[model samples]
Target: MAGGNGLLEVRIAVPAKDASRIARLLVEERLAACAQVVPGMTSTFRWDGEVTTAEEQLILAKTHRSRFEEILDRVGEAHPYETPEIIAVPIVEASAAYAAWLVDEVAAGERP
Candidate 1:
């Protein structure tokens, strides 16, 4: 429908406490076909004027280019970070069945 055979893997880093809620939001809105949350990651970064570290969770959302924008907007609203890390990496390769399934799933919720 909206996207082609092309796919994307969107990565969003969120606070550990909000991980599950964010995952459910993406899947429920169908901005993502699936979202896998990986926790227990120690992230080090510069905040304010000092370097800091915190435990965070990573949300890997499987979707397509068609849904990337929506994912960004929705995650921005749902995320706590002033600037959430939202990155989309093109999926260069995937099994035929899996790719097709991914497109179909994401397309279902896309607006006309």
Candidate 2:
């Protein structure tokens, strides 16, 4: 939903070849604590008054809600699509230890 634990799961759909690069960028930039690339996704959507289907890769990034806008901007610059699918959903529940690790990994002004 809206707010929960200050953590987020950001999803970005990109061409298969660009998945790793985008994931690495987010993690290396410390905007996300972790980025996982899931390949072989088949997506069908309406574009330019036509239905299109394509194979895509999904990048799931774990980060704080505070970093959403920055992630959006960065993905926009690197994404090939005119309108990339970049969305974040709150982490409503998480193990205490894992949550702590995530926060520590992406803490502002700190490198891990």
Candidate 3:
């Protein structure tokens, strides 16, 4: 079993249309233990030398660090953005039960 301390909670921002689709796929593929889709996010940024704003959805994915690259690959293939926003934040602390459950749920039937 992979260690939980190395786990991460990844955040990816995608257009609202693709949030549910990508989130479901990630969880179903076991790349993410759980995915939370937050809608109605307004993003303001500079693009093409002009400031622009757009409505987007945020996907928060929980998974072991060992699967980071795999998660990235999946997101890249599934995302609609030309350069999707993919960011990861390490979980310094988490409920042991939740962490364990996350590992179990994301595994192919393995338990930690």
Candidate 4:
């Protein structure tokens, strides 16, 4: 999702054990300016035509919209699930200072 600020709030759900590693990877690689790993989340969903519930970790990542595809690719490589839950929503509005900081941090690690 794109917006005037060109910022996105990406959400990625992973196994609780892998939460911190994934968050660190994203932030270290600059795929995300910041990543917060929220643990103790219980997710219930359908998989393979059956209902299931599992403990999960939610990683909330803040990044520029342009870095979304890279984030997906990187997460896919690191994630254990066959189809990981990776989604993003546009950050339609943010404080100017925060927006600028986010953009700057992500941009600092831009690929050639």
Which number leads on lDDT?
4
Instruction: Give the alpha carbon lDDT tens digit for every residue of 1-112 in model 3.
Output: 3344777889999999999999999898898999999999999988889998999999999988778888899899999887889999988788889888887776763325
**TM-score against truth, every candidate:** 0.93, 0.92, 0.88, 0.95
Local distance difference test, each candidate: 0.90, 0.90, 0.87, 0.94
* Higher-ranked by TM-score: 1 or 4: 4
Ranking according to lDDT, highest score first = 4, 2, 1, 3
In model 4, what are the clashing residue pairs, if there are any?
none
* 4-28: candidate 2 lDDT, tens digit per residue: 6899999999999899999999999
Candidate 4, residue 32: lDDT: 94
Report each candidate's C-alpha RMSD, comma-separated, in the order given: 2.7, 2.9, 3.4, 2.0
Order of candidate numbers by TM-score, starting with the best? 4, 1, 2, 3
Query: lDDT (0-100) at residue 55 of candidate 4?
Result: 97
Q: In model 2, which runs have C-alpha deviations exceeding 4 angstroms?
A: 1-3, 109-112
Q: In candidate 2, list every pair of residues with a backbone clash.
A: none
| Pairs with backbone N, CA or C atoms under 3 Å apart (clashes), candidate 3 | none
Model 4: per-residue Cα lDDT over 1-112, one tens digit each? 2257789999999999999999999999999999999989999999999999999999999999899999999999999999999999999888888888999999998998
Candidate with the greatest TM-score versus the true structure: 4
